[model samples]
Target: MTEKVIALDIGNVCIGIHPERCFGALGFRSLADIPREVLFLAGERFERGEISEAEFLDGFRRLTGSALSDAELRRAFCAIIGEPVPGMAELVSGLAGRGYRPVFFSDTSVTHMEELRRKFPAASAVPDGIYSYRVHAKKPELPMFEAFEARFGVPAFYFDDRAELIEGARKHGWNAHRFVSAEEVDKILG
Candidate 1:
């Protein structure tokens, strides 16, 4: 019998994230105050570990034209991380107890990853994962899928909130689904 593996995304799947919180903390009136394209470009580099935390903070300051200190920036950055999706921790633990391996596969930066592990039970529950900062790639990118396949092989079930990411996993031959809620996941996998 083959081992059953479950791939999970962190943001919006395991934990709820609000970018507006981070922006507001940084003194932006709203998310619209920031340029989406530039923010994503900087964020992608940060998530890919191509830039150091200091460099990312500097980029953020430049982008936002804020004079906040590094500590303030770090706090604001982490403010984006919200509460864990309710019941995800129990769901992951139940899956593990039932002989399925649950692993986190997320496009995340070092700071956010640290905060998630520290603050969220669901994140701490599954110790094994393929992180974008560690893998130097994000979802929908072939390298990310290849890394997952290399580590855990195929035929795994993946849950994420993004359609493109689901399509990417399907293209790589993994079973993928759009995550609705923990109850939905429990029903499907139970």
Candidate 2:
């Protein structure tokens, strides 16, 4: 039998992420305090590896007019990453034991990815990954889906917290689901 391929999103699906924590760590009281250019444009560019890490930090400082040092900026940015989702590591192992090849499909920056790998076992459990930084495209984009199809031949199933990303996977002819909880994934996989 052909091995079943399953794509799992890393951010909110495998590891909990709280962007508010990052903003708070950076001394922002509310989301409104962050500029759209810094939050969206610079972030997306960083995730896509269009800019170097140093450049991203420089842009952030220039845009926000903050006095944070490079190390402080990195720490604040990585603060968004939390612990791995409960039971997600075991679920990943279970998927492997059940003959499902689990792979990470995510849009994440280098700093966030490094933090996740260092802190979350589940985030590193899956050996295979197709990241936006490497792919040069983010989710909800055609290029990401195309890259997945080109590499893995269209995943048998894809799970993500975002409905828009799920729709993107579906458009690529994959069975995609909005990930809610590990229990929901267990039921679906079983």
Candidate 3:
């Protein structure tokens, strides 16, 4: 018997969001527009849970020199998250029908995840979530997949928009795909 699992990426795969758009909303033209120190070090710290949400917000405010209120800051930060991809709910249901457990696998911060959970019903439907902050690990890092494998076992199909993440899953000897569209995912899952 093939012990198969399906891991879905929260951003871009099931939902649409561009990180550059988040940064742009914060006033930067691109991530490269931010100071290198903040973008690299502070970003890693924020994603890996080394810093609290408040600290990250403060750092972002200082770096961007934005006078936006905390509420506004959160709005800007979360503004990148857009609508759920069409047919995602049906795809999840179909995956379940095929005996594959669909789980969320994402490199997202607690604040972002909380906002998504509160705003998006599709996010709430997953049986479980494996987040970078919770594990203190992010994608393209071997340990994250190791932790995932330990928790859900190596996924039979890991779908992500980023090639680096897909490569990481493949390095673990698991099948992985670079997600393109809902139709492609539905066909592949079928």
Instruction: Go through the candidates in order and give each one's C-alpha lDDT.
Output: 0.85, 0.86, 0.78
Better of 2 and 3 by lDDT: 2
Ranking by lDDT: 2, 1, 3
Clashing pairs in 1: none
Over 4 Å off, model 3: 1-3
Off by over 4 Å in 1: 36-38
Against the true structure, candidate 1 reaches a TM-score of 0.93
lDDT of 1 by residue, 115-155 (tens): 99987876656888888888898888888888887898763
Which should have the higher TM-score, number 1 or number 3? 1
What TM-score, to 2 decimals, does candidate 2 have? 0.94
User: RMSD of model 2, in Å?
Assistant: 1.4
With a 3 Å backbone cut-off (N, CA, C), the pairs that clash in candidate 2 are: none
Per-residue CA lDDT of candidate 3, range 1-190, in tens? 4546788888888777767767777778877777886775445887788888898878877876778888887777787777777777667656655777888898888887876676565554576878888889898787778778788987878889999888877887878999988799877877
Ranking by TM-score: 2, 1, 3
